[model samples]
Target: MNLALFFDPLADEAPAWGSTTLGAHAARFVDTFPDWRSADLALIGLNEWRGSAAGQPAASAPDAVRQRFYQLQRGTGPCRLVDLGNLRNGLTLEDTYLRLREIVAALLEHNTVPVLLGGSHDLDIGQFLAYETLDRPVSLSCVDARVDMAEEAGAHAEDTHLRRLLMHEPNFLFNFGQLGHQQYLVPTSVLAALEKLHFETLRLGEIRADVRQAEPLLRQADLVSFDLTALRWPEFPGYLPASPFGLTAEEAAQLCWYAGHNDQLTSIGLYGYRPDHDLLGLGAATAATMLWYFVEGYYHRRNETDFTSRRFIRYAVGLPGNPAKLVFYKAKRTEKWWMEVESLADSSVRRIVPCSYQDYLRAAQGDLPNRWILTQALLG
Candidate 1:
């Protein structure tokens, strides 16, 4: 595929960066686009913002984010990075989504993770659709201030994209988990509906109490979409309907780190940044820092999925219920945990799902863990 035809070269002049900076290490699109096939991670900037309620173009948002991202220090190890430049917006919103889907699918086919710098949160619909060609169900995770399930007349894409994803045909979405959603902002009916579907959701307070608990949910995700609106106002002032309360800047970076460390996670989108709304550049700096942590965590991955290896310690807990026992594995090196769930209809089929230590404790007390129950329900 001729990738250059779909993208326009970055508009800004390349800034001179120091030897230790990310700009010095990354292959960016200035005069030439980078070789994406060899890159471990590819950055694609979306210049289409018609999906936003404002219907205003965020033409400079990606470059604003790039300005801060390139100035950061490089990660611990050698980084194979590429900046593919900005995706040229199409004549219609759907055209832009199709372009994004094709680009993301191409990158995924090459086993390269795409870090999308978005024009709006709805672009994740394109990111999600890219997985359809894989011919298997995928788990999705999103961090947002509110669930974007708006069904009202003439709702903007950012407001109604989640509904579109959940209702997309071919039914390839295996699991959907939402993090950092504020209860008051979300409709009761929507929350009830999501719960009835057995989808997982963690309120802002639930996550803020212990951020580490959110790791397992992300660990199982094939893709993650992060809306900058999930962060508190002044901290991330570039997005609309700025809130006084939301995830702290530090918490947002931690979540990104966890997402980066997940071996199963393939693509991630950072969205809802508007350059016109940011005068102090705090939002850009925050987004840049989150990206930096994600890269740092990516290089530090342990590849601990091989449970049969000597590096893992296995434990079995007897249950009083129909499924007589629960099997758990703990990674000796990283201390991460996983539990096994046998299919209800077919005992021969089992799934190794990421879990927290708290889950193990719950099972030891003869109570089923919520994650275990949810996974079993999904399998059934």
Candidate 2:
């Protein structure tokens, strides 16, 4: 698998030089990662917007520099050009999504794990669709400061990406690191819609207070989508409805690392790397570090467990003195995983599932065994 799949959709002037669009930091992220022997890295260059998410086709040089880029990435990486530019090839929404679905399907079918460097976060819609085709269902985890699920109140274009994604299908999503949500900017009806659904959002305040607290919610995630705008000011400045509260660069890296540790996670994508807003290469550099942690975390998790699927099981430590209440949750396969949320009223006694941590940690889904139910009563 190529480590660095570089795609430059902004050909106007080229960010500044060396991935100027993503910023100098992006170049550094690419260069430094290879030094440590991370996964193989491939840079796929694409012509400027031939099509926006709206599918507006633009121009490209069939024989231009991008053509050379396309050729170089073919045999060099885990899969074809990580296909970063959407509009450059797809002139309309359907056109883009269709091409993306095929491209993503091929990579995943062959188990070529991809780390998407998107032209715009909207490109994420294609990535999502690709995995939806998989026989095994996948979980989506978003790390951003804003809840991008707002509807297009007549506004069109790339801005409405998250809004479109939520409406497509019923998929498991975990929105992490959201902050700076302004009522004037995002409609409450949209938030209400999300509530009607069963997705969960972890706000910035909660994470800043304690990152570890979110671990239980993320343990079973398979794919992680990161929007750079979630970082606090000075670290990331371009977020919509920019907020003063957000994760620090170090925090983002740690979060990515933890995400990597999730045995079920398979892919990651980093978006919104606009060099124009980032004069220096700080943002790209930060992103590179975050990616590095993801790699490290994955490696660590891989080493911690035996390869035999039967030996590895999900693990969890319930909050002390909670309740025996249980809620069933689903995993990728026939396995069973459950969540127990109980009120500790004076903390007389409460017991949830009683099983080996090794066993319960790995259970993805199913009804609790009769013995487990009896154990809750015994402990209570």
Candidate 3:
């Protein structure tokens, strides 16, 4: 299967906000990574946003301007951009969402993760709706320095996405790495509402201290979002609202690794990459690093599952808990297989345990394996 979908709207022609450059970053890194030589990843271009359909257009100035939004960074790979040239500005958000969703849905049909890079974070409001075109119980994971949830108790606010999401009611929402957020950006009441919903949070300091603390939370989500601005300015020099105490590209890469490493997650979007404001290709290169990290984790984790034999069931114990004290219990489903880990001796570490495959298959799926082959495992 094609591993990922690289979609760039080229909706905003301005050099800084263009997802095209970000897409190039992903392609370049994949080419540079030694492990990705055989990976079946494709960077496909998406239609231009032109700002007319409904979301905020680049200028929000006129519907008639054409060729207004275009941004592509330098890179080496098979990166394709769907150049719609210039789109009319008169289009409404509803119109944009409807058409854009159609395009996104087409990509998903091919088992692709529609990258949908660019235009505005407001584009995410539409991207969320596009996922509705597929299965239910859709979830979203957003990584940013601030809570885009600024719409409660006030008519107007920055990050209109908070209000937009409330209106759409996505199945669930998980937020990570929100540090140094100001009340003026999002009111305290809004944060309270989000907290009530069980949104996962990783403050800058907390995540920096240990990213493994967020493993379980990342696993529970279905779709994830990454706001490049979440990184500290020194680490990620390409975002518009860069922060001083944010995630470096490597740390952010680790977080993305966990998200893509999960089995439940189905879609991911990278938003808020501003190449125009970048210094000496730092932003583009970091964005590429983000994609490389995600794709690497994605394929690596996926290959860990073994499905060839019907009767056997297999699972790997993740590397977070201490393995020295983990004890496996005999599974009830099958006499030959072992069951769950009975004790976790240390909270500071995590360990992945691979048990009898046939037993889990029988218990979890009511079937037993005729043969078994362990494709890969992450129990270290």
Candidate 4:
């Protein structure tokens, strides 16, 4: 595929980039588009915002983010990064989505993680659709201030995109989890509907209490879509319906770091940025820093997932339940946890899932961890 055909090259005037800055290391489109095949990560910008629920346009938001991102220093690693320039907006909103899906799918086939800088949260629909070609179920994690499951007639794309994704044909979604949702911003009925489906949800207070708890959830995800509206307005004021209370900028970066560290994660979308709403470009800087931390985490991955290797310590805890015992593995290198769960349909089939030390303690005390129960339920 001639991927260059789908993009419009960067148009911003070049600035003096420092020796150690990302602009110096990344392959960018100046005279010609960079070769994406050699990249470990590909940055794609979406310049379409017609689907936004706010009924606003942000055609230049992508470049606004790039201006800040290009100024940051590169992380410690072999920097094989490519800037594919901004995607050419199609004649219609759906056409743009199809173009995005094709580009993302192509990048995934080459084992290159696509980091999308989006105009609105709805653009994640393309990110989700890209996985359809894999023919395997995938887990998705979404971070937003409110659940975007509106089903009303004539609803805006941003407000109803999640509903469309969850109901997408072929149904390859294995698990869906959401974090940093402010309870007051969500409808009670919507929460009930999600709970009935056994989907995991963490309110803002739960995540704020301990950001580390969100790590395991992110680690399990194959793709993540983050809305900037999930951040507190004081720190990031670039999204409509801004709130005074949400995740701090540091907490947002931490979650992104965790997402990047996951070996299974193939794509991530940073959405809900509006340059018109920003003050002093702080919001763009915040998003750029989050991308920086994500890259840092990616380069620093420990690759400690080999449970059968000598680097792992295994433990079996006796239980009073029908399962009889719960088995866990702790990686000596990273001290990360994973627990085994037997499929109710076939006891011979087992799956190892990411967990935390607290879950191990709960199992040791003869109590089933909520994560264990949820996984088991999903398996059944």
Q: Work out the TM-score per prediction.
A: 0.98, 0.59, 0.57, 0.98
lDDT of 3 by residue, 1-380 (tens): 22222222334333344554533333332222112223233332223333212333333111111112113342333333222222222255556556555655655565555544444455556566766767644546666667776544642322666557655655433232233233344567767765554444456666777666545446545656666777778876755545676777788778777776666565666666555566465666666566655555566553332333443444433333233222223323332233333223334433232334443544444332211111011111
lDDT of 1 by residue, 253-370 (tens): 9999999999899999999888778889998999999999888888888998889999999999998996889999999989999999998899987889999999999999999999
How high is the lDDT of residue 367 in model 2? Answer: 38
Residue 252, model 1, lDDT: 97
RMSD of 3: 12.3
Indicate whether candidate 2 or candidate 4 has the larger lDDT. Answer: 4
TM-score for candidate 4, residues paired by index: 0.98
The parts of candidate 3 lying over 4 Å away from their true place are 1-90, 152-158, 169-186, 303-380
Question: Which ranges of candidate 2 are over 4 A from the true structure?
Answer: 1-88, 169-187, 237-243, 303-380
Itemize residue pairs with steric clashes in candidate 4.
Answer: none
What are the runs in model 4 whose C-alpha is more than 4 Å off?
56-59
Residue range 99-164, candidate 2, lDDT tens digits: 655655555665545565534556667667777767554556677665676444654434666766
**Best candidate, lDDT-wise?**
1
lDDT of each: 0.91, 0.48, 0.47, 0.89
Question: Can you rank all candidates by TM-score, best first?
Answer: 1, 4, 2, 3
- What is the C-alpha local distance difference test score of candidate 3? 0.47
Worst 10 residues of 4 by lDDT: 52-61
